[model samples]
Structure formats: C-alpha cells, structure tokens
Target: MFRRHGLRATAAACCATALLATPALAGSDGPGAPGAGDDYFPGYGNGGYDVSHYDIQLRYQPTDDHLRGTTTIVAKPTQNLTAFNLDFALPTKSVRVNGAPAQFSQDGTELTVTPSEALPEGSLATFVVEYEGVPSTVEVDGIKPWIRTSDGALAVGEPEIAAWWFPSNDHPRDKATFDISVAVPDGTEVLSNGVNTKNASLAGWTTWQWRTTKPTATYLAFIGVGQYEISTKTGAFGQPLVTAYSENLGELAGPAKASVERTPEVVEFLTGLLGEYPFEAQGGLVSSEGMNFALENQTRPTYSHRFFRNGANTSVVVHENAHQWFGDSVSVDTWRNIWLNEGFASYAEWFWSEAQGTGTAQELFDHYYASHPADDPFWQTLPGEPGAEEVFSKAVYDRGAMTVHALRNVVGDEALLDIIRTWVSEKRYSTGTIEEFIALAEQRSGKQLDELFNTWLFTKGRPPVGEATGVPVSATRVAVAPPKAVAEIDRTHALLHDH
Candidate 1:
C-alpha cells in the first residue's frame, strides 16, 4: 500500500513548465492509465501520477440542487504523459494543465485531459478543472452517491463519492490533503473534513473554508451543506473539537448530541489502546437526511440520525471514532483489504463495551461465536478475502472482529495491545494489508501466528467450540445477545442504503 516517497516539485515550479509545446504521441510519451488497477473496482483511481493536494471551491444551491466548482489538483506524473484521466461525473466546463488550456473529453465518469504540453515523468503538474451540474442527476450504474437534503446536499459515501462532487484520483491508494471551500446561502451551514478555518459572508452568501492537516483518502473527504446547529471546543490536548447536528433532526437532536458530544472521551480511550491520535482535529456529524449509514469521513465522522432514534447510542460513536485510528489513519491497501477497516472498528465497539462494564469482550465474542452455526453462511465468506461484491457483508464486520479477538487470545492481552500500537504507529497516514498486519503481530508477539490468522480470517467455517476461538471452555457465555445499543452497531452495515 505504500508507494515510494519521491521528491515533489512545488506548484509554482510545475506551472512554469506550461511554456513547453505539446508533443506527438510517440517514443515514451502516451496517455496515463485510466485506473489505479485495484482488484475490486479497477476504474477507481488514475495512474501515471500521484496527487498531493486538492483545492476545491464551489457554490451550491439547495433549491435546485445545483453545484458549480473550480478544483485545482497538484500532482507528479509517474510517467511521461500526453493525456491523463480524472474520475469525475459532472459536466466539465474547462480544464487547464500547468496553467495552459488543455483539450478535454468526458466519457461517463472518466475525464480525459490532453495537456497543451506533455507532462514529463518526475515533473509536477498542476491541473485546474471547472464544472457544474445537479449532483443528484449524475448517475452511474443507477446509483447516485450524493444525498439531497431538504436544505442542501451531502457529499458522503465509501469508495465512490468524490466523482459525483469533484474530480479526483478517487482511491484510498492516492491519499492527499484537501482545502474545501463551499459557498452557500448565508444562513445555511457548511461542514467538511478537518478544521473549519474561516467563514465570511457577503451579498447573502457565506463561504466556509476547511483544511486538512493530514493526508485523506478521496472517499474520506466530505462536505455537508445545510442548516446545522454547530458546536466547537478545544480538546484536553488542545486539538479542535467540532460537531454539527442538522437543525432538521427534530426529536433525534438531543440523543445525537448526547452521543456525539462524547467524541473527545472516545478519542481519549482509543488513543490509550492505539497510541496517540493521528489527526490534528476530532469530531462527528449527525445528518437529518436519508443516508442510512454512518461514514468515517476523515477527522469528522458523519452519522444517520437513525443511529440515535432509540436513545443515546455511544456504541455507534465508539465504532466510528475507532475508525479514526484503523480506517482513516491506517487505510486499507485495496478494497479487498476492507477488513483492516471494518474489522478493527467493530472490535473497538466490543472494547468499549468491556470498558463501560456493559459486557466483557470475551462474553461478546463467545455469544457471536455460539450464535452463528457452522452452516450459517456467515462463516462461509472469508473476511480476509471477501470479494468486491461482499466487501461490506456481515463477514467483514462481525467475523472480522471475531478474528481480532482470536488473535488477542493467541498473543495475550499485553502482546496484542503492543501489536496494535505498533501497527498504527508504523502505518499512520498510509495503507496496510492483512499480510502486513499479521507479520507485524507475529513480530511484536514473538509467536507463530500464520495458523491463527488463517483460521480466523481465511478459512470460513466457524472454529469448533474451543480455546482457539478466543473463548475458554469454562467461560461464562452471554445468555443472549448484548443490548440493542451494542448489537445495533453490527446491524448498521447490513442496512446501508444504496449510495
């Protein structure tokens, strides 16, 4: 998941090369690859260049759901390229490569840009793209990732939201910093990833600027434009803590606040287990829209109001904030390695349950292991290699957590904690794989773990009721499933609506 870190040229230095003339498609010069070559969604990220930053400016109108924007991308070409592709779906008005007008065409979601001059290998290139459209109408495979709210829109989803709102190297493999500025009606609030740096208003419009201090995956970068009750504070460590609740939340607002307000505490708890928090900020967002799933959108995770309909549900909050360590900071190498994200986050919920005295981690693990039968199909799908279609399946979340607990049993609590701390410390802001994680665990624990990981993650069938499953033969098992608050976290992924 880690690419070689190359020396990057400044945007100014790259734009200066705009004087070069366009070259014929001969010799070693050609077009960039259309995709980053992921086994799951091959057309996700673009090749031939690595993106370092995205400066996006947009004005959104809620009434018509119209969005207009100018996005600037700073990248370094991995190859000499005549043309390159950006995963985008909106109607592109214009494109400039290195400040020179470039010929561009849109074929579905792929925006192919032919620079006025070839972008030489190892040279930085700056691309500016202007586009406008109703994001809700831009559909691919009958799916629209944009969520239309009563007040504005929500740019949130996993693996596929960036293309609908902005042009990007839309893959976790290509992590980049972001500066997102959105102009909406003066009274409408705008929230995005990272810290909200500034807000200014004039002529009945307010533009909010947010900047990320750390590299973020394309899907992890999000924007919400709507009426929100925003809150801000400083954490014990002095990091900014900001949260937003949609004004339209109505009855769910109180519970949402009750749960989300504890983000700083959850961050503190997770930091104790996973080492220092990785980002410069911490927070959560609760949306009133119809989005059914909660997304770990970088520093601020976004949730569906439904997560708190029953009452204050911090279990869901614990699940997402834990992702700040597992998913956001240490991303998966490819979609196939999604267990690295969901599994670890799900395990955090059980960890929180144990800390809260609601249930023991062993009891929770035993309940799940005993509940699902050998032929339950839940055991048939391997979490380590859940194919593209079932990447978000039950096996990835529940079975994935079980796998973590199994490893904890084999390595003991102290060694397992050391392994987790070392894993995140080493892979922070980068991508990792199951194999890498297994090797790290073995190295830290000083024990052979290949068979343990294989049985828990690869081989499907439920492990025979024994010590290998992380449950002692004489341990007290949960009489029934844990309370709904904890159980609901596992069911949230299954109820995810189409993005």
Candidate 2:
C-alpha cells in the first residue's frame, strides 16, 4: 500500500467515465481487461467495467469480530460483458445481478461473476454480493490492510489493501462514489467516509449510513467501527466536521482532542498556502489500533495511539492534511506515481516547520542528506517507481521531500506554491502522474527542471554538492518566531514524560 493515507465520494452518472474505454466499441462483444493495466500490482483492479457507485452495508458482531455484509455496485461496461470480477476476500453467501442470481466463484481475492445476460458496453449494471466472515488484517506485499482494534477496526486500504474489507476493483485508477452503511451492537458506534445521512436504531442495533459526495478510490474508502465518542462542529471552511475517539484511549483522549481541534486552524493555514480545501466536510479520528501510521482518509484522517501518546504530533497532522490537496484531490493515476501523494505531503512538513520557524525545508533536506553515507542505499533509491518492496521506503518520503526542496530551490518559494496551487485547482476530483507534475513545474517556473528531477528522483547516488536548494540566510529572518509551537511542543513533552 502507498502510505500517508488520503482520498475518496459522490454518486454521479458521469463517474463511470474513469479512463474511457476505447479498445472495444459500444456494440463490440468482449471481456473487459482485468487489472486496469498497472505496471505495479498487475493482479489488482478488475477490468471490463467502470464502477460509478458502491453501496456497502455491513453488520459487525463485536463479540466475535465477525462481519456480515451485502454490497451493491453500480457500474457500466467498457466491453460487452459476459463476466466481471470484484476483488473480495470474505466468504460469499450469495451474489446477484439485476435482482437475478448470478453464477459466482471466489478465487483468492477476486470474486468472479457470470451474469445471465451479457451487459452491453455503456449500459448500467448492478452487482450485489452477500458474505459473512470475521474480518481479518491482510498482509499484502508486506503491507497492512484493515486492522482489527481492541474495540474496533481501521480500514487503511493503500495499494490493494481494500479487498481485505470490501469487494471491488481495488485500485486507485478506478475511482467511484460510496454509500457505506454499517450496523453495530446497541452500545457500539460507527464513523465512516462522507456525510452521515442516517443514524437509526432498530432491534437492539444501530445503523449508520454515510454518503460521500465526491468520486472515491477504493483505497480511500473507509469505515471506523466500535464504541466512539462522536463530536460534530463547523470546520475551517465552514464545512460539516466530525471527530471520533473511544473512552478506551484513557488519558490520550485529552491530547487527541487538542490535536484534532487544531484541524480547523490547520485547514485554514493550508488553504491559504495551497488552495481551497477539497472536501465538503473535514474531521479526524483517533483509535486504539496500533497501525503506528496515520491516514489522511478523505474528509476525515485517522491516527494511531502513538500520535496521541505525544499529544498528536502536529507534524504528522500537517503531513496528512496536506494530502487533501496533493493525494486526495490530485490523486495518482497509478501506484507508480505515489510520490505525487507522499512527496508533496512530506514537503508540507517542511512548510509547516518553515512557517513556524522550527526548521526550513532546506535545513530538513540538509539533515537527511548529511546524515546518510554515500553508499547507504538511501541515496540509491528513487521516489519514482521505487519497486514493490521499497514502495514506502524512505526514498519515497524524506528523499521525495528533498526533491521538492530542490525544486523549490530552482523555482523559489513563491513559484513553488503557485505551481502547487495550480496543480490542485486543475487536478481536483481527478488524477495526475509524475510526468504531468514535471510538465506543470516547467510550465509554472519557466525553467527546465529535467536535470533536478534526474538528480533527485531518478539518480541512484547522492546529488552533486550544494546542487542548489537553500533560501538566502536573510530570508530566514522573515519566518514567524515559534512562540505557540514552542509551548505546544513543551506541553506534548510533558504529556509523554508524565506517562
């Protein structure tokens, strides 16, 4: 899974138009290609149909951590479809197409279905599935998927982790809207992606229905289920905001609240620095799940207890929330272009640091560059196409941000921010690739950046000495003095030391 999580929503007929299928005509009879032709993870993402929306309804039994689910998908065929596949992991009870029982079989993660009637290209189809099993954490290519918590679950579906919890074309390339409804025991609660449309109790169970009003990638779709203390308020942009945590967190709850409450101000800050916030609502979630990672999940970001342990790491918050623009809005078209998500978010930490006078981007870049030895393997890694095993490697994070720093050095701070703002505005609710970013940088900076990219993103060795990427010493004085962050850092240290 590509990390630093963020992405999603909405039911639009136009959503079926992800990478329009031109191979087969409307009347041409054929099977849609499985796996949307991705260079990495060839087995993920089914071919043949473009899904418009997903209606997922599941009931979780806390006692056994068992989940029974019925999922309905609305999609359009790219080729005249005889059979299609959904990447599902749970044991299947039944499957139906257009209300008629469909022949279905599960082979590993893919749930293949043969409809009674062939679906013509451009025609809409509905496939529904019923399944029940204890949802388990999946280990895919050494990546963690849906993690079962002490009292709940966190769905972190980077790369192909989505299939662990729900069945669908589990790839970022195939984006769709979602309506997630989860039912829990009487005392339990659920917080998922998008706006809560319904919260009702029946027969000693409560069902929470959420609707996402934006096209969401399966990896970005999420469901946090268990006993949660839910809070709602207006966000920075006045969007509907929601945050959740459990009493099980104990003392960490106080710091979690304080850290999450900073979201409004963070959004406002990033909004001015980047562009407008992408989602209609904004929030965050804290869980006992020990993912040791925080995900920028659509409108709501999810954090691990470790973050709250140190008063919710503002740097991590800056990293994830920045994903709203870089990863969530201007998503990567393929897993190969993950640097577009992580690199920008990583650079955002530098941006926060610079603004608060903690450290400049160049200072951070210098720290990493100087700390690592020449042949330390870190220098040999590339952020772009960092093979499967090293997808989330430091090369994708620190080096990626260093690449941004190098670019910022070339284009200057103002042009860099302008280029980012432009990229966010242009690619909102859509996807882009590394090449597109390069082109955008050149266009915005009016300078050739090919060399910088080659040295930072493509090279397998340390870049040349002092290859340009530091602001003038005089400019450092312009940054705001760290009065508040200093206090906050002290408070966090006290919290951690107290425990």
Per-residue C-alpha lDDT of model 1 across residues 420-465, encoded as one tens digit per residue: 9999999989999999998998889898876777888888787655
**Off by more than 4 A, model 2:** 1-27, 137-144, 466-499
Task: Report the lDDT tens digits of candidate 2 across residue range 1-499.
Answer: 1233222212231133233222344456765554565555556687888888999998997777788898999988877888877888778899998889999888667678888888888887999899988767434334345678777776765665567777898777678888999998888888888899998999999999999988788877888887789999888867888999876889898988887878888888899889888887888888875466667788888877667675656766777789988888788887789888888887887788778787666656656666576778878878987865566766787778878888888888899999999999999888899999999999998988888887788878877654353323433232344334434323322322232
lDDT scores of the candidates, listed in order: 0.83, 0.75
lDDT of 1 at 380: 92
Q: State the lDDT at 15 in candidate 1.
A: 39
